[model samples]
Target: MKQYNIAIEGLDNGSFQQQGCDTVLRAALRAGIGFPYECNSGGCGSCKYEVVSGEVENLWPEAPAVTERDRRKGRLLACQCRATSDLVIRMRPQPEAVPVIAPRRMPARLLEVREVTHDLREFRFGTETPASFLPGQYAMFALPGVSSPRAYSMSNTASGGREWHVQVRRVPNGKATEVLFEKLRPGDELEIDGPYGLAYLREDAPRDIVCVAGGSGLAPMVSIARGASQAGLLKDRHLHFFYGARTPRDVCGESFLRELPEFGERIHYHPVVSMPGEGENAWRGETGFVHELLRRRMAERMSECEFYFAGPPPMTNALQEMLMLEHRVPFAQIHFDRFF
Candidate 1:
């Protein structure tokens, strides 16, 4: 039985003990150390880290985000690699560090659930203990009879209370969605854990912040934007939101977004539709994919602005590529959470 010390450098956050056989990221999470990551399956590059010291074995050789250049530079996807020895990895800052709170598990009871669109549902639940999380962070919930927990981002920031909210889409056979839409009822108890993710708004973000959200991805952006508005953070910073949907019927949370503009004219909103149905031609807003629309409008200043996005893999992946390769936006300036 061998355990290794995993030291994450450059943050006051110290080190943790990890089993030699487990991925560094997994061990970090299990150790309750807040680290940057999303799509822990290695589909997204959020967990890519430079191995400052020690060695690791690639547990998942087919990591899509790891490049040959990354390997040459000693970078590995933390989610796909297990530490072979005591390790020191230089990593990103923990988003919530004013005072960090480790992930916790608790019991939650379903309070209310309602359909928001043809495919989207809004759910309200109360945790057994009050929980606090960053605006764009998410929680993992294990429903009764389900073998695994499903992650859902909060639609609002942690209010330092027992209640929280999330928006879900009806995936044809998604375990949590099915349980939420078909079997779950108000007062059903479930196991919950987390407040995980790295796509949240940074306190030091530039004066101009751009958010692009597709489908239910708008949930977290709404949370960030609303939180900023409520805390008076938007007064000095410009907030621009691009929300996309497949059709008019798929749009959700218009009223919540509408209030953002009242924060000030600097708060802008773009609701784009990818496909407009018959008689929907009268719509005067942007069209096509959200990334394309953003490129058309902000291609000139993208390299200078900070960007955050949350959405389906296709949307987030394409947008990240477009911003980095085409717009020349710095990799460090773009943050994303890709929902699988």
Candidate 2:
């Protein structure tokens, strides 16, 4: 691996900086610099950065992240470029608190596979590399023959580490997950590249947390809640995680969670169902659209707590607007991964 020195001109950081050998976006994200990116794939063109001088090796030439015109304009995908020489890249910095997990194209064996719900599958991978990530963040899991990777949130948040735990939802006709569901068994191997994404728990912020998730979205929320419980963090803060499901059978681990000592009061689990079955009676929990439940609950104490919304994009985006415009939670206090 050859060393590369990158001098980011016009940036406030400094002049000639030694980049050594690293992918451009991976290096920047590792430094806690907020590099603007979306899919982190060449598909979205979100991580496109201009080359001020020198040259770089495009790791993925046909990355969808950048357009042919931009590629001709010297605009290459940050996620695709590697520091091959003393290059000068004029790109934005990723924000602090964004832990960088350098991707490795390695083989991991399927350790355990469980169904969280009808549409969700909890797949565990045993990897030689350790996963270090913040609670509430996500990563991209790649498999062989798949042109693009699927994004899922980490179930364990261990920074200064590698990759640990994650939860993923199965899409209909989704090749990766479909194969993972049927053919993938313990000891089966597949290719993975990730430890990407942030938008996790803002521990530095002083406020209670209102986490709204659906289906597998509960993975990160569960991880963060468990972390907070273990560390006795946010003792004064209350955690309200409302998981949405169609019926009780569609749900997974609420009983297990309620058994945890710290979860009795400090944490509240509200499982809302859209339609109760015929035999299932005595339903006391909230019902209807999950966001409406959030609206009613958050509307009262909206001023006191911070909001972290996940799950599907439509729900998150609509809730974001509701929290900011309707409930009055400040923008700075609301943290969500709309894309993740």
- The TM-score leader among the candidates is 2
TM-score per candidate = 0.77, 0.77
Best by lDDT: 1
Runs in model 2 lying further than 4 Å from the true structure: 1-7, 12-23, 38-48, 51-77, 80-87, 97-107, 157-163, 190-194, 246-249, 274-285
Worst 10 residues of 1 by lDDT: 93-102
lDDT of 1 by residue, 86-120 (tens): 98898774644212456666789999987778888
Give residue 135's error in model 2 in angstroms: 1.3
RMSD of 2: 4.4
Model 1 root mean square deviation, Cα atoms: 5.1
Q: Over the stretch 1-340, how does candidate 2's per-residue lDDT look in tens digits?
A: 4556666667766334335445677676655566777556565566778888887788788754556688688888876787767777787665642455544455677788766667776777767776656667666666666755666777765644444566667778979777777766788777665556555676777777777777667887777676666566657778887777667666654753575566868888767776656654634567776778877776788878877766765677678778888877778887665553
Provide the lDDT at 52 for model 2: 85
